[model samples]
Target: MTGPDSHRLVRSPGVGSVVIGPAADGSRRPDLVVAADDAIDWTVFDGLTVPAGYPWPRIIVYEGDDTGFFDWARRRPIGTFEWRPSSAHVVDATGANINRLWIGLRTAPLHLTVPSMPHGVLTVNGDLSLLTAVLADGGACPAVDFQPDTLPAADAVPLRLPDLPAFAGAQHVTVTVRPLRQAFDCASLLQFPDTRHLSLGGQLVNVAALAQLRHLRGLQLRFCPDLTGLPALDSWPELTHLIAFNVEEATGKRLRGELRRPGREWERSGVSQLRRPEWFATEYGLPFSGWPAAKAKKATTAYRTAQRAIATATGPDGVEAAIRAFVAVVNAMPGIETTEREDAGDAVAQLAEDTPFGDLTEDAQDWFDDARDF
Candidate 1:
């Protein structure tokens, strides 16, 4: 008898043939990724046999019309359904990839829906029409990320949020990146019904409107220049992780919630896990903008300079020195506080994220803590 640690094939990412390999994490048979690189018909898998008790494939459609792909994938439990382009993937559950899936980034304008699919991330980047179609198809993911690729010209109408899905399921919702100009009220948010984590960007106009979301466990505010002050943290019973940096002394670090970097441009929350603080600011709200002309210019110059250094590092090993330099800059700043310290640390994490240096996760948080004193 074989030991339980023996490897098994989990998924196959082949076309015209079935290519198998050992499961890196240890399964029963050889493992493979099921998503094909090219847009192929579902019939391609007809010849790929599975053991009687093994599960069917969970395919990822990277390009082309998914009408046919949906017809086939929806047949099974739809274990993990994703219509992401090579770019449109969202794996932002902080670090959990077991019951949930990590969806990718999609730059193209396409709408796809697989009804009654299991929990995953839904990210729409081109138009609200895409969002509309997916909801219409009865598709639902626990997390919904809505970002329109571009804004209409000043003379044109801005994109608007589509009506909420008829059923309730979303647990984490992010309406950010590229502002929505159609004038959104919080009522559009109330429709989610089950959202425990909510993130909003430049379009935020009022904070009081969130009073009704008593179930919220976390909230993230990004670039809300028009934001009214936040409500008292204690008012809500379930809210935990909120804003990271405090601009107003009224809240200080006394906020009842901890801070977390909201999901990023390509890496939703995190594909693996959010181990420690990756505290990069999404730029300032009102306080930094109101600084004296020279002071504001200096801050921008400092940040941009640090960014250039980080990106131009000789290699992965050099990123540490570059990040350490950034910490020096933050520590040397005038009136250094939690906000400034977080900004410096976050800038490194956010910028290094996609680079080879980012994989050096164990060293990052410690670098910030070791070099800087708040």
Candidate 2:
């Protein structure tokens, strides 16, 4: 009996045929065998005459002694290659002569260490032998404590992360490449861009091409102060949480009324979760609230008096959109103090019923519904 172990049978690149099987009584038939598409298939068994051109002559015999299941995963790359697990499962596993193979990478120069089918994580670490730069003369992997080595060279240069086709089911992708001053391709690691988290932090890049990543859900941009305005995020309907710090505020009056409001509410209510010493600006510590009763009558009177002074300057529609979007984004963040959700939800309901925004109100209500689920 063959012991527990995996096996491989492969010939040269262009070879046509290879076969393995058992004799009459089926004693220890070379456990597993693998073959090629352009190859011939033939077999012979006891009491069975030489049948010419049998439909599938190759045979895989599993004797009665062992109760084990056989799995076969095959990839045939003829200019087009796919290492995806879903596609790997449907390969033809008809005969014993054609043994089990796995879905793995088969590219020039760079070799891959892919996982077995059904469920396996795909990993591509920075290895010199396994990864080589195509366009540049040569490459270097630097030693940074927190970040991945500088890719090719940082400034305005184009660099490629080797593609991993089997990573279709990946949920999270962490790239060590930091101070990324240039554009990099993440299309391979996150095929379903809307559903996955794409974290880019500690990078020197000014503007990233994240608009192409349509399905991106979570984004963490830290210390990327050079970036002026975030790309159009209204398209990312699936996006739940966005953490941005030190970003330039071209619209200060807008952000003043938006991002700084809910945090001020937590601070006013003596909630420690919203009070971070790192982000504290002495001028920005004033109390603010979304609900009607969080402030006293005198405070509310003073706020409305000041609000009237700026109401004409800050257009009503724009202010409403910013507040609603900000509230939706903050509520989506985990561990957030969810005190004003009912108030916010009621506000959305009123807007939906009475506002001139027909489709926009519906969209806002859907956003709040999803955000409150977190």
Candidate 3:
């Protein structure tokens, strides 16, 4: 092969710089051998030829790295070739409708990117170290980017890549923004009609615009502390999981209220007092101060828990520590256990006696009376 830069040896048609020649030691080069189309005939074969029409079969070879292999196969469009020492095969795919894939099962470093693969199972025989796949927008292929890191050894699982259309068609959609941030607008992405799982981890994003996702299910805002507050999630009734770690009180409130129901079931680990305190109030509302004594008891539980954590800590301010120790001592000095709340229903009923009360209204008060007894 001769080019503008230099001259190289070659013997194949349309295949440049790929040829068999003599070595410096006068030995023949078997590394560049080309075999017949159906020549599964060779004993120690490293490469093979595919006569036009048929799909490439699996190839098991003994080559170390598959970098050059993929380059040659993609360029030559040959049939499957199996090097020595490897049980896996190689394939040369063509056309947009191609599906079948033959992934080698060695620890060799292979680098190739396929935008789309047709509907089929692409099996990998071994661990795919540092493997990456990126699909285009609206790319058509029922392919699942299966990352089965936990598959048992000697177990070959044929992972079918998930369909992009199927994911896009759901009531929730997730997107990675590292690559498409420049080409696509973040605001436009948030406006996806049915998108829900917006995981903007380590990606440049606009937190406020996310409110446009009316059907959002889960929002993962990991390591995005610069995001001041969360958007109002009342618009997104379907939102369930708020996977934010360090969100401020304002943002946390919105997330808690949207993802959790008010009152007892809503309380969770690290729940801020600002968000749902009313849920523990006497009026069955949050921000519990205005509520009855029952709500005060619930708030007292939280205060007691905080006190225990502080008490268990090693170092404390001298004055505050003394006060806490004194309080603990006073608590240990408990004397009596019984105290009953003045039942308001009885008092209200006694007052109702002064007015003209019907029997039905009295019976309704009896229902309240029964609730208090329970």
Which one wins on TM-score? 1
lDDT of 3 by residue, 288-322 (tens): 22235654454445334434544454443322342
Q: Give the alpha carbon lDDT tens digit for every residue of 1-374 in model 1.
A: 02233324335443222323222221222223333333345544444544653344543323322334444543433334344444332221222222322233344443333243345655555455433333434334547776644432222443345675632567788876422233234556776767888887644444576777778887776544334456665556676566533222223333322223343121122111111111112444212344456555665666566567767877866777766776666555565533344445555554455555556545767776787755
Ranking by TM-score: 1, 2, 3
In model 3, where do residues sit more than 4 Å from their true spots? Answer: 1-185, 203-205, 257-260, 263-374
Off by over 4 Å in 2: 1-110, 116-123, 127-148, 151-153, 180-195, 204-208, 245-374
- Reference-based TM-score of each model: 0.42, 0.30, 0.28
Candidate 3: 10-residue stretch with minimal lDDT = 176-185
lDDT of 2 by residue, 86-145 (tens): 111222222211122222222213432222322222233333123321211121111111
Error of 1 at 279 (Å): 13
lDDT minimum window of 10 residues, candidate 2: 136-145
RMSD of 1: 15.5
- Give the winner by TM-score: 1 or 2: 1
